[model samples]
Target chain A: MNTFTLGLVVVIYLLLTAYLGYVGFRQTKTSEDYLLGGRTTHPFIMAISYGAAFISTSAIVGFGGVAAVYGMGLIWLTFLNILFGIFIAFIVFGRRTRRLGRRLNAHTFPEFMGKRFGSRGIQTFIAAVIFIAMPLYAAVVLIGGARFIESIFAIDFNVALTFFTVIIAAYVIAGGLKGMMYIDALQGGIMFLCMLFILVMTYVKLGGVMGAHQALENMAELVPEGLRMKGHQGWTSYPAWGSEWWWTLTTGIILGVGIGALAQPQLVVRFMTVKSGRELNRAVLVGGIFILVVTGFIYTAGALSNVFFHRQTGQLAIEAAGGNVDRIIPLFLNSAMPAWFVYLFMLALLSAAMSTLSSQFHTMGSALGHDLLGTLFPKTRTNGMVITRLAVIFGIVVSMVIGYKLPGGIVARGTAIFFGVCAAAFLPAYIGGLFWPRTTATAVKWSIATGIVASLFMLVFMHGSESAPLGICKALFGRDVLVEQFPWMLVDPIIIALPLAGAVLIAVSLLTKHESALDV
Target chain B: MFGINSCGIWLGYLLAVLSVLLCVWYGAKKWNKDDDSAADDNWDSAETQLNENL
Candidate 1:
């Protein structure tokens, strides 16, 4: 746990990561290998890479902090993560995505959509949205990783940010998907083991599994007065239905994170990295267990951290962290975890951050170089790799700038907002394009446009979490939200926008003749 | 259930476990299945036609 030992550990980890990246670089002889891992990736590597990329430090630290405040009600999000994110994603969507990619020769998600719909305009538009909206998500992950580095190394924030960004950038830009997935598999393993230990150790610290839950249940009266008024029952119970807390938990956190997983460009692209349906089918087992352990343990440990904090200092986790939800997990670890484990957990957190960051950066680069720029300038197609590497650097720089400018306490909100937007903007079109041969290119265009506009409008004018800070509604309409009614503002954009997007897509698809030439 | 009184919360936990089991079963059952070629039968021809139209 000494500074020298921690430094040595980090150096060794970085060396391993660099070596993996180099291996990927050495293997890369063609554009296909750089972009899609030659479309023959091992099922285990593909599954773990997907899991690691999907579970970021934001999910662990930010949402875990939220679980500390909200109790085990977050178990629903974990359930949905396994069900929708892994099971349905792999079995239902992954198999078809692989086949479609192979058939269309698509290298990116936007490309897949564009080629499927036989519309260059749709591809450019999807790529444009990804290039524009994804940096905030990437920035938050960068911030999470950089902050951990800052605390562990006791360095300046800017220095940590630079070091973290540069290392991830080096690997992603040089090795591309192949290098990134190898590192992701390694990081995912670290995350899985660390979280498992944390879960068991937390139970041991809290006396036992059932005892911990019972104690938390007994502490229901200890719920803060404000949250109680919002209908918080206990650490072990759901919030009262129709209450503000219930709406936020169910709509904002649960639905947004759950359904949103289906449309993520980075995650969707992973399906294309494998060779066939069989690989995807085989991947479901590892992906399912990996997601369950990583997310399930964090939410469980986070909720139980309340008991640890309360018993140790007669303060709830939220109060002990002085009202900053993001600080609860770190505080709990510093307090309860052994020194050596804390040091080791730093690597796990680093893995979480870097794995997600690498994927986001890769997705952004592909969106730019392969989908947007390549379509806009046909000449750029010849040097697509070079263009993508440059775009990766651009994405990193933009994310770093945004990370420096963003305010605190935005981690969980930022994550949910991005997920909600992606869900509304991409999910309907993605699903329709995948399964419904009746889905027309024109309908997908309208659907995507509707999703983007509706979700943005809701974020700006209706959703209290985003609108309050954005202040666009307040400045224009003299209110924090267009609807001042209770529980309305807490409703996430995805709930309303996704339905609307799907309706538009379906209505348009039904009214128009199916374009058989573009049919899959 | 599991010291948690809320049916919804306990159900959520139980369902999370069961979902993983379902995934495992599904994966094991269909591990060697080769259905992609049939699904992709139209892809090559469709791509050729679409490219010509565009």
Candidate 2:
């Protein structure tokens, strides 16, 4: 597509998002309106908003790139995304969360946790963790969208990042959750259409399924001796059973992203926007179908792109785009897609990036403005609107700086780090508070504290490249750090930390007696 | 691009199975008309007590 047409499509989409923000600004009269859409969002809008926020450019770019490298095994992640992320998330978690949120009269995720458990301290601590950790994820998402724009349009990387940051921040700060949801619904629609078109076009370009597979199968015979030895025989087959690659595929990509959806604060807060359980139930199908298409199409096309690119060039798309796997989707779209589809695809990419970014910035700003500081100084009584707007600006600035400094793929990994932390810190408390009658404030606090401490210690001292310099894990364990030496450490912290946190919650609640001294 | 690949066919079948299961679950939950005498008894007695009081 010509630069002018592509830019025009993006500009029109931005204007539509801004118009939605304007509508939200007029409708919003109270802090509750700003935070939870006046507790009256419709099922369709709610479902799309939740789905859009749940699947960002990270899914399309980062994981798609990973698929280009790893092959069709990543499709399991897509299946789990629908079954767990959408289906179970909406029916099991969404209904209960909406009911409890309404009962507690909570606006934000931290507020919901705090009010449900009757602990101001728990709320503040969760807000603190969110504010501290979420920027990493937000920055990674920013990188994914900006990198795509830079690759397609040849714009400067920092310029693209800054433009995206400002556009998202404006709508979220001005319009709030209602505006975010409206734009999300629109973005969600565009994303669905774009994915469907890309998939069909890719199939047609490859001359149908049988022809394409035969070509890929023939090409598989030419796999480099080195890659064949490493177990990459072809892009046509699943990885060998019980291989190290298979484990990473199943655990890290599939289970990690799928299970991590349960504890995402930005997504959970969407449940609080609707009026009743019935509304959430109605949204279940809409949400599931949306995820089934967006995620399913993305993964299917990503896997198929292997054949198209490999047949044309001797290398996988990821290698064709240098060593950076995240660039594969953008490279394929720019080079292989029809010119007009490229224009539409830009809108899809914009929708994915902006929808998720607005929600992240809103969630981060609220966590900082409402929960953390509001708890420490009970008498402040500042207007939430003003405070939230300022916090949005603060969040945008911090995320942009991080986006500028970090490499694209590293930013993607950083997003996984935050999701893991949220699962560790909040999942037990969230699940227990909803189901267990005897869950206490003390247990909630202890569980959160332990989960946060363990995850942070591991992330800093064990997971990344600078592990040796940090060395907190080494100091504690008298070792070179288990995560670096063992592949299992890469994906094992959540298994250990989540159970430990849950055990603390259960044991502590059982051990301590209530202050009222009432019979159980 | 793998047009008639078995992988594609398997994926299609998997999706079809998923859709059918979802339909069956929703249909059974929404349309099932089995009687529950114990719950009915509780409701009948409660109605009777209210009528007597009136």
Candidate 3:
């Protein structure tokens, strides 16, 4: 817990991280190895790496703090993370994606989609969307990491942001996917062990598991007056079914991340990194368990932070975190965790943040260099690795700008917004492209455009949380929302746009002449 | 009908447990099955089969 000990531990972590990067760099001679680890990665490594990349500091620092405010209802998001994110992602999608990636020799998400549909336009459009939209997701991830570093290290925010960003960028740019996955496996292990300790220790800090829930139930009246007006029952409870808070929790967080997990271009491409359907099949249980433990423990511990805060400061966790929901987990650790564990958990949180950031940066770089620039200038194919490394630097700089400018409490919202947009924009075409041979490339184009337009319109005009600032109505009419109608502003864009995206894909596919499913 | 109370939160926990169970059940079945149909025996040959034979 002392400076000397903390310094020593961090050095050890850095040494190990560098060793993995070195091994990855050495083994990665060709572009293929850099991108997919020669397609021979161990299943356990793949599973843990997948889970770690999928659940980052956003789950821990950002959304965990929201758990402090919203209570156990956030657990459904965990359920969705496992059921949809891990279960279906690996079992349903991973098998076919791996098979097809080998079939078509596609290395990136846009490449995979473009090759699947046999459309250069589809590939270019996807590449452009990912290059543009992915940075926002990456920025929120960067912010989540920087926030934890800033809070715990007691450093200036910008300094912490730079420190974390530079560290992650060094390895990701140098070692590529091989380095990222190897590092992810290590970080995933640290996260698993630390979360297990946090769960047990938090219950001890409270009276016991059952007793903690009781104490929380007894403090229902302590729910913030604002949240209570919105239908909060207690720190241990869900909101009333149809309340404003319920809609936000259910539609925004749960559905946004739950169903939205399926369409994430980063996660989707992870399916292709393995050699065989058997490897992906073997990874399902390991990935599910990893996701369940990491997400389950964090959500549970985050909800219990309220009880811990009340015992410590006679205040709710959100209030004690100084009004930023993102700060709740960091502040709670400082107050509740043992001193030695505090330093150790710093590494765990770093693992949570860095593992995710590395993957996001990798995805952004691939989207830019391999998908966009590579698509534009096919002659630069020989310089693929150099182009990707350059894009990684660009992605990091763009991420740092947003990390600095983004308002507080936007971490979780930013993550969900991107996820929801992807669900609406990419999910329908992705699903149809995988399953239905009748899915025409032209139909998928319409689906993608519809998804992007509809989701953005709803987010800007109808969704209450984000609509205030960027909504069309606010911009045009100087009013809050386009419609003064009831509950129109209450629902998140995923609910509105996802169905429309799916419908468009179906309608266009049904009317069009089909090609061979494997024509690509 | 739903309230953020002890029972509701516990219900979420129960659902999470059920999901893990379902995942395990499905994963166990998938693991036990033989996937020889998609084995990575011959890399370029597999690509050729996929491109034309399939």
- RMSD of every prediction: 2.2, 5.4, 2.9
lDDT of 2 by residue, A1-520 (tens): 5778877887887778889889988888888888899989998899889999988887787777776676655666766777777777777787677766765678888998888877787898899888888887888888888887787789998898888788888888888898889989999999989888887877788877666656655666755666565556466666655555665566556766778788889999998898766566667667767777787677667767777777678677766888777778877887779878878877887788888888889999889878876678755436777777787789878888888887635656666667777888888888877777687888888888888887776666655333444676678776546555545554445666778889998998888754211111
lDDT of 3 by residue, B12-31 (tens): 78888888887777767777
Total backbone collisions for each predicted model: 0, 5, 4
1 against 3, candidate with superior DockQ: 1
Give the distance in Å from residue A260's predicted Cα in candidate 1 to where it truly belongs: 0.4
Per-residue CA lDDT of candidate 3, range A1-520, in tens?
3778887888899889988988777777766776777787888889999888888777877777778888878888888888889878887788878877877788888888899988878988998898788888888878877876776667898999998898899889888888889998999999998888888999898888778877777888887789988979886778887888888888888888889989888888788888777677778878877877888887888888988888878888988877877678878887888888878788888898888888888888888888888888997779988888898899889988988998866777788888888999999999888888889988898999999999888877777777886656777878877776756788889999999999999999899888534642
Q: What DockQ does each prediction reach against the true complex?
A: 0.67, 0.12, 0.41
Poorest 10 consecutive residues by lDDT, candidate 2 chain A: A511-520
**Residue B24 displacement (Å), model 2:** 9.9
Tell me the deviation in Å of residue A510 in model 2: 2.2
Kindly report which residue stretches of model 2 are placed more than 4 angstroms away from their true locations once superposed: A210-233, A461-480, A483-486, A514-520, B1-54
Q: Largest DockQ belongs to which candidate?
A: 1
Model 1 over residues A296-383: C-alpha lDDT tens digits?
8989999999899999999999999999888899899889988888877889999999999999999998898888899999899899
